[model samples]
Target: MSHEIEIHADGTAAFVSANTPGWHRLGVVAPGPMTVPEALKLGQLADWNVRMEPLVAAVAGSKCLECSKPLGDKHDDMCVTGDHEGQDDSRIVDEHDTTHAVEVPNNRAVVRTHPVTGLPEVLSVGGLDYTPISNEEMGQTLQAILDQSGAIVDTAGSLRGGLDTFITARLPKGIMVGGADPVELNLAGFNYFRPGKSSEFLITPVRVVCANTQAAALYNFRSRYTVRHSPNAPQRIIEAREALKITFDYRDAFADEAEKMIKAELTIKEFERLCREIWPAPDPEANSAVKDRDDALTGTLMQIFKGETNENIKGKKTRGTHWSGYQTVVEYLDHHAPVRGEDADSGRIRAERALVGKARDTKELAFNLFQVA
Candidate 1:
């Protein structure tokens, strides 16, 4: 598949083109297992473990757990039955709707407190814009959907929530778990098993990377062995202090190489064409970043920084609020104090250092084996 990524000479990341054609993507958002929260933040943040396609599934069901819904699956992954064709399932059921088991919409949405960050965020599930409200409020009129997805990673030590580690296992499509009930797994166990404090569900989310292939397999192996991230002071920064400090579902190495491959694969002209497609402008690729007026899209990245001066960039011109969104990230890393461990670089992160961490951690920490595959 075609892709677009930017890598620096130092093997660091620049950015991965989310608009590349023929590129399969697995978006591993870094906020909450709650789809709504992650999606909301995705529309705001940067330096996340971006992929070509969503690979994980939000686990559901209780007891001898059965397969349920999946957040990221190919269109043909599964199918559901409905009443008459072209009619809403409810209408058929209403023969007072003889209808039953209708196909659900894909673009799901939601916003909720994360297991760790606790910061409220928007999540993207099945389709993209799923609502966080219970299906009962909309579906069962009293039912709710509580699901989360990602690879299973063990906890570092322990914590509250009776969950120290957890996994985001996938269930059969449409299946769900409503409240705090227990579920069991066969060989793999539930995708997300919040066992108890100190050991619970953890997701090693692999993005657009195809797990069926050798590359993805190698990636998972590395995740099992890599040293975990250690957070310093300022624990109150956000609920994600511990959550974001994790290293799983290795996309670090793949993201790194992919970024370089994307840049090298595209010439300056190709890059321009892609920008136009994904983020088009009237005069794309003009000699100067700005054409005639001082619109956000036209202005130079430098000009935006100069005018905004590290202020938040609204999505209006920057698209995805690139300016201010990126600025927020820069500020986030800027406030990150030095590390006290032997694993990560023992330095404070800043504008450049933040991205440096991003590059190193994306696929490296996610899946890269100390020994090359």
Candidate 2:
């Protein structure tokens, strides 16, 4: 499955792409760019009225275990589920009353009512304080950005069975790096881990070329806005219009940096120095395993640099340029870096880090180093 795109219980793909089809080639596809409202409807994200509901457990009991008193409609003690090492202290059988529903404290179920059936499906669980930002609210957020920025919806979808959701918008124009490759800017909004605690917005600039360049762009996000879910989250989202201004500022700054990188040439020695700084030589006493990995890593980066320089960008060769070196590091980290496990879950973990986690920090370091070089 492409990025574990969520498949709804109704067998429809919970994704939609505008203008072009995604790699998975599933979900709804639009022939042209869409407004935020259009994208939401096509993406099956229009009616997910997500809300928090109290979690309750059924306990059968007439008398309290400790005091032998007639247990009323409520029970305050701890309860256990099923059989395990501990005894089933929660369930008590009452001849008069078979079951009494007691609310589980400190936790809630994230639920969405089915539009057609009126039934409810529990999407996930969270603490009592965890607030849900409904799909309608997220749509309004996207619409607000489009109204302010003149951007069009590019794609929208849910991942991992609607546990995580996202929407991306394409900016009006693109920056031409090195007077050749066009780097397009996109605004991505994401809510992770099943109506997570916060929603994240980021501006990403990507070269409209190869997968490597796209990955580099994904790793190159420099401006971000985050709003934690709370009673005031909706108001904060409304105020997030300021993010559009920040987006333009970040675009201008990135263009300047890209121009500098493309013009500054790197000598072979300088390239070696850059590698040494990024991946310091292991101590002599360090195990052979550590040293071997480091050596292999540096070697791989060198190989990538040579290949990148040879590939012509818009009729201009990037040979001996810091731009080539920067691409080398980004491509390696994004595609060639060693990650634990070979499953889709592991891929998601790596992708997450590449966006705003450890890999992001490393990419930024490389970019800064090249700017000085």
CA lDDT scores, all candidates in order: 0.26, 0.72
TM-score for model 2?
A: 0.81
lDDT of 1 by residue, 178-297 (tens): 111111210011111121111111222221112111112233342222111112212222222233234322334434433333223223343333334423465666755355532444
Which 10-residue window in model 2 sums to the lowest lDDT? 75-84
Candidate 2 stretches with Cα past 4 Å from truth are 60-99, 115-117, 193-197, 211-221, 308-311, 343-353
What is the alpha-carbon lDDT of model 2 when measured against the actual structure?
A: 0.72
Cα RMSD (Å) per model? 24.2, 6.5
Which has the greatest TM-score? Answer: 2
